[model samples]
Target chain A: MIHINEQQVSLSGEHSIAELAEKFKPDSDIFIVNGYPADRLTTVSDGDRCVFIKKGETPAPEEFQAMLTARHTPGIQEKIRKARVAVLGLGGLGSAVAAALAKIGIGKMLLSDYDVVEPSNLNRQQYFTDQIGMLKTRALRENLLRMNPFLTLELIEEELTENSLPSFFHDVDVLVECFDSSQMKAATLRSVLTRMTKVSYIGSSGMAGYASNNSIVTKMLQPGIYMVGDDISEARPGQGLMAPRVGIAAHHQANQVLRLIVGEEERRRDEHTA
Target chain B: MNILLNGQEKECTDGSTVLELLASLKLTPESVVVEHNHEILQPEAYTAAELAENDQVEIIRFVGGG
Candidate 1:
């Protein structure tokens, strides 16, 4: 049986997060909730919602994971397996991001990048020497599949323009912005801000430089817009970037995506306490 | 010329470095992103760097985000 905070309720077929929020009023201060690890409020199974409660009322990580895993209804698993995510770059940051998402069993991934894998990218990007000269999307597809055979990865080997933004934003739960070029990053952000509403989260990664210590900061831009990077560090116009710094930034980006997948409100509340 | 610390432009002694300006404004290095002359200025270089005349600086505070 399904319930929202002790009141019994039933969700029919597929529904948007808006619909669920409208019906349940789950945003209330006292409403404890859980489910949809990737998207807590979007749509979830009976079992997932059963465990949700007020912000500080939850169980420990081990206990919670056990409950969610043990009660893994086919419906919830199917939802996770069918989710579509779009990654907007394939550089050091995007490459590692796509790999982490793939490992977590995200059903389908749309890898977008028009650039070719260069020797310079090997230090941080997951691509191999054999992948040189290949389009980044192609390389990511092959690499992701190797990580998880069950994943369905797609490729869009083109620069994102105003015209392409509409179709690209369609049906995706989240968008990962990993462009290296500052101009391109700004353009993509401008277009997405104007183009779509289906995009629940747009995670943007900024300068992840060679310095390991000073190059990691994660800022939540808005409800769904997050900017991950040192935001403070930079490479001199002609300087080179290394692996560890970019990898740390990439890892932070992936962590935000996971937090969005689970419950952003909960995460925000926790951040406040910390 | 007067330059803003956050939003208020206060007079400062000549040859003030970014670090000195930050101190004058009572701002911490960890809490702001400085933009000077239309470019995003890196925090690490802010200390060794000096401010110039007619320069407009935008200091944005860092907030927690996901």
Candidate 2:
């Protein structure tokens, strides 16, 4: 017998596995009293408490995955199976972001990019010579499928216009902004905040010019946006844009997405407790 | 001489023009934006664009955004 989310749930110490499974089969994600992920009927020792958190209550999928795999947890696979994300760029940062999300089991991705590949892009963008003439969105779609055959990708190869931004973000759990221009970044951010309902995370200023380690910073912006790059302030004409920095930013964006999914209960709990 | 291209330092051998560098990178002529020393380099001129020591070259990929 233990307390779950303040509710008392009594379990006989000798209860069989089937009985325990029935008790835990409510379709909710479960966590242990120790903040570990757990499933129903998980072996319990004396004084171990359990909490059941309802699924679909979180916005981030990666956090849910971590919790699913966390010791003493039921597993976050169901939540991962339901996630849908939109990636709004296919350049260096966008390529890394879309690839990471697809590989991590995101059920679907809405990939949007208008450019074509160029040889110079090989220095930072995740594309090969054979894809040079292909549209960026189409190239990313093919590449992502190779990485995750089960992934469902919708490729949109036009520039993001005022008319398209709202509809593009509809039904998406999260938006990954990977634009390179400050003007476009500003426009996208404005649209996401004002016109879109789903939360968004943006990446700006990856290796843009010649700066050292001090140039790269990964941080949250407001409630949903994250910026990854070297100091936009220190950018020379060609010193801060490259693959390493862009990849780093994309990783951070992916982590934040994960954090949103699995850590919802904990985050809300902490918020309430604080 | 060395110039920074998209954050990497590349050696600039004598007579290495922007077009030569673009050709070396195998970049398609119409697909990217090149900024040399703060000025946008047009596609046709990329062939003859000469880079100086310490110049910063930013080859940017355009992406869809609202």
- Model 2, runs deviating above 4 Å: A1-74, A231-236, A264-274, B1-66
Supply every candidate's count of residue pairs whose N, Cα or C atoms clash at under 3 angstroms: 13, 25
How well is each residue in A72-98 modelled by candidate 1, as lDDT tens digits? 544554455566778888887789888
lDDT of 2 at B58: 72
**List-wise, what DockQ does each model earn?**
0.05, 0.03
For candidate 1, the per-residue lDDT at A4 reads 47
Best model number under DockQ = 1
Give the poorly placed runs of model 1, Cα more than 4 Å off.
A1-79, A212-215, A266-274, B1-66
